[model samples]
Target: MEISEMNLFGREHIKVFKNRPKAITEILSDGVQQFGEKVAVATEEHELTYKELDDLSSIAAANLQQAGIEKGDRVAAVIGNRHEFPIMVFACSKIGAIMVPINVKLAMEEIEYILGHSKPKVIIVEQEFTKKVRQAAEASGSLEAGSRLFEIEGENTFSSLLEQNAELTEAAISEEDGAFILYTSGTTGRPKGAVLSHINVIHSVMNYKYVFQTDDTMKTLIAVPMFHVTGLVGQLLHVLYVGGTVYSMKRYQNEAYIERILKDQINFLFNVPTIFIMMSTSEKFQNHSFDFVKKVAFGGSPIYQQTFNMLKQAFPNAQLHNAYGSTETTSPATLMPVSYPEAKVTSVGRPVAVADIKIMDSEGNECEPGESGELYIKGPMVVKEYWDNPEANLSSFTDGYWHSGDLGIMDDEGYIYIRDRKKDMINRAGEKIFSIEVEDVLKSHPDVVEAAVIGIPDPVFGEKVKAFVVGPSLDPDDFSMLKEHCRKSLAKFKVPEEFEIIESLPRNASGKILKNTLKQVGGEKNA
Candidate 1:
């Protein structure tokens, strides 16, 4: 079958890449020479021009060399969305060190698992999270009980690069060498490390640049956590790849402050649905100017129609764009123009350049037009492998296509619509929550015989968790106590909103609870 028959999404937006780049270093080396003296990264602390970024990266590379880090070494960055974050990634690429961006938003135990598996030579973390880093290190026994962590604040860390020689190093990598190790949400099992090659990294970034028509004139605000591929690939990596300026935000909770900042010089934005939801609903957005903000790209999860429509209301001249991708694909696999209000509201758009998408049924049979099924992608931008994980690598790919594990349908016009997750993962405020984890916790209560977890629609959190428990001796008032138990054991976000004491759970012959049956009977209401 042709690309169109297999992929419901349009083929025009997909970018084809010739897997060649050994590293993304050249994007920076050339960008600095051309856009030198132009602002490349900015935080409240300091601003770096493209030349200075080039210089700092060289220095950081020198430090890495002196520290015994070489080709294929894993370099972890536990910092937030600061200027130092991008610098470290570029520096790692220079010396062939795979960049492993640790999610600072995750719990300490979650952080420990990533650091342990990645085996980073050294960790660059913010001082605020210094203790957490140390704790995580201790938890994993990877570093000394008390390992000294490199700290970054203002331009202080960049000055460390100055202390070293700012000499460039020759690339010692191939297209197959690991360029990045991005951890999955770990919603089900432990997080899997998706190793993206340099060529894959460059392909995804270049796709973002070309598709967005980004240029030196384009300045994007960086608010999404750079630890995720969406943030690293779309906001930080793509900016350097295309010679654009980045106004960095350490955290995005302050919607008003972010709007005040983006109100000024930004022409582009790459944020998740929540970021736009907060901005479009904020009082600050009520008065924000959009003279420069052009293409506002959003992904990570679905956005509500209310939040989608408000974006245009706030930015009368801005065009919305939807980017559909996963950690395994760097950032975007398909990007459809969300220019029209209706399109922006419903479709996730079309498959991006070079991306081949197919929606298949349970038996791997191709779904008909407008039929929802498991989404699979094949492209140069696909991850090379899961680091040190052959079993995961084997399971991840089928006939050279990466199984996205997401249920989606393609329309006649190449517009993709997401239905649900195949793995029973709950998207709570942009964070993936494994239903099994919550179920395990609830089942541990001894009184509960069977438990099933499902995501109920929430206005704020794309989906709020609601667990239905099938057990004896539980009253309506007992739910508060059960919820409290969950609070003590799991993350607050993982705790269920409400619980129903059902006589019995609906189950198939395989003994698997039919969660859809639960949703049919009053589960469609609120969590």
Candidate 2:
């Protein structure tokens, strides 16, 4: 379908699409009936057919019920990319429970915060990480004495739990009911759960199906972390919705990723540009044949034109797409049409058919074409609210539209180009690093007086975290000590890659850190 045909709103400038499933369970049930024996999902360890997927998920639901889980309860999972991850997600949907996919790389304190905020009735974790979860549970003080903790790996594990229960009767679920609560760092430096509904996820699935032109013949390789919305909704759920096969890896290993693509004859690849760069530069990439690959979609971080051109040469037959969205938008709010790779290479493309995008000024007035402003999105795919966060809701949403906090401009032709971010968030190789979160950790140091963090341009990772600090000492060893302090509380990706000891940070009269000045200072220091 062409973009013009899919645009449901005209001069009014709103976007919408039709024919979304009422609930995610409908997608699961329909997939089973339509593609019963077809391979649905494959991991390094196991593969499941559509019918088998349905049966296993139902069994998982029964097991949860047997453990006292019921509708409206929360189930948090800290497992990696594997067959059980999606199975547990579907099982939660089957029983009308909310799935909370926690980032496995999160530190104990970060995990504790989410556990305390969500108060999940159960937490399913990888065997190796059970101790961390247990610590988090203890720290959060939210886990009841009877709360279940299921390890995904071991003899009596996630798989064995499935075998113990029979198929369960699917619960009646509403389109508006919460399906997943994806946690993202807020401006306040704490993570807020973005509550995505069943309709929200289905809307995203439809958007992916329409934009990617996916069908039953398509075979996808998912190397991105399944806990992230890009991999979960954009890759896994989208492929499931279209009755295609999904080959997932536990974690992205550069060499293994290339091997899997060639081995499985993966036709569709949706990942960030970093993986694409790694694959293209690898000796194995040039030696192997990618003739079977048909489509390549990338997002999460900016893609350089050089990398884009290299990718085109690597997969000659593939159609390249640049997509843009967030956890709040389910997956993609905008996708660059395959036709615009050359002419509009830098733009994030127009809003998806079902999503409305507007660049609004501080006064809430829509900006004229070519003018930059904060991006606001409105659609069924947009998240309803941050779970239990009234402050976030009051600040983020206005007039039924969610403020994206991304500064962008739309050309007269309707293609959107990202200019800058209004929020103090860093995108390092597709991993989000909130500056406040990092700064909070840095300032906790005994010797630290003040800290300011910013994103500095990096050729490989798009942006790398850089911190400027004013402390009692400018000693080089002190920088290492501060980094170690952050390591205990922050994810590896959030740790500042570069640290500069400055006398003082640039600030305005009102005491707000002048980040633009810091960017300039960063550029000068690098120069």
Candidate 3:
């Protein structure tokens, strides 16, 4: 594979993968042609081979067309980790419909917001979330007179789509056509939909395939939500592109995850740091050998050094990688190269092959090495703009770069280090403090299982550091011990001024800590 420059999305001279699938539909066609009867995606109860996947998605596409879903129409799905979700993705792609995968874990109100915003012609949902989805559609006025709803297991169901006998018409879709509108995790404010085109997803999948050096033999367990870019594009689509197998879980549990990996001989593993941490610490995970796993990737939050060491011990033969990206970047902006040095584990590696990263200071000047600033990424993999939001498009994107809103520092070796989200950075009397740094230090303690840091209001310093620690049997003495532990590693001001021991931290479906929720908690505690 080579890199080449192309005029894309009305932009001149964007770097793109020279050899890649032209559209989302091409991924399935290539899989069918190459892998044929090989299993493409499977859940606990259902499995679909490459040939069956193609036929079923074609049938579903024809069914959608018969039901008034035309090209450029939005088809929203409230699907969990199941075979139907991926099937729907391909079905929408076949007809050039932009799929909107709404997070199943969201509350009714949140789902309503997404439904209202996307205004899909058809809504497909897993049976478990049908009631909520229907209520949301009704509340949001998305289920207009002509709109339709299909439950995964009901009278009007996803199965019916496969059963219908209709002609599957080939759609005229280009690499620049919209494929998906993934809603970002609304940790701060309302979630915005990042509209990804065919080229955006194709390049992202190619980046994963190229960087991991994966092939058709790759077997991945998709435990993350399919609504997210990590699970959908990074794992599922990436595997489909390489003609590999995908094993999906309805929900991730320690026992099920361990069992599936060992039973299926899963080789490629990509998940959040928290999941890896939980798996590494699980007693069940210790009794088995994970030598079969060849690649391990984690992100969504900073990885603690202790957790990294534990993962190394668990998967000795695995090439551990730290990846950093968001829905806006499709999935990966930076993926740690294979066989990365253990010392560089703290860094999130260099930018992906076609992507360029620049750290820009507050004044918009490019920062020098090791200088902290906002990370700006520009590439074909990056989405052109937020869906239908001109204001966000104007504010978040400049020139060809998307302002990531993430504070980062790139070392001389070109490795990127995420400090914190710009909103998460604390300005305590003009002394900058990144919550990830403090959280990483706190999680290094042997007893601490997880940690979240937020800025609390302070009249003198404007804001002060507050930490919520998760541990087993935490008490007053443990707090003192933890305070001393931080004192030795971090500066006095960087150390948390207030600490509260909680059982767990709140997180969104994407596995990112909800720091805004923490701020609310801090405010309530003070009140």
TM-score list, all predictions: 0.76, 0.79, 0.98
- The backbone clash count of each candidate, in order, is 12, 0, 0
Tens digit of per-residue lDDT, candidate 3, span 1-527: 78999877666678898878789999999889999999999888899999999988999999999888999999999988888888899999999999999998889999999989988999998888888888999999987645699988886877888886888897999888999999998776788999999999999999998888889989999999988999999899999999999999989998889989999999999998889877876777989998888888998889778878888888888888899999999999999998777788888889998988999999989999999999999999999778888988889988788899999999998999999999999989999999999888888887888999999999899999998999887886777788899999999998888899888889888898888888999989976
Position 339, candidate 1: lDDT: 48
RMSD to the true structure for each prediction, in A, is 10.9, 10.7, 1.1
The TM-score, computed over Cα atoms with residue i paired to residue i, of candidate 3 is 0.98
In terms of TM-score, which candidate is strongest?
3
For candidate 2, lDDT tens digit of each residue in 327-407? Answer: 999989999876873878868888988677889987889999988788999887888899999999889887668898888
Per-candidate Cα lDDT values, in order, are 0.74, 0.82, 0.90
lDDT of 1 by residue, 46-120 (tens): 899988888888888887777677787788778887778878878888888888888776789988988888887
Candidate 3 residue spans exceeding 4 A from truth: none
Give the residue spans of candidate 2 off by over 4 A. 1-16, 154-156, 164-167, 185-188, 424-527
Candidate 1 stretches greater than 4 Å from native: 1-15, 18-22, 144-148, 153-162, 165-168, 338-344, 425-527
Better of 1 and 3 by TM-score: 3
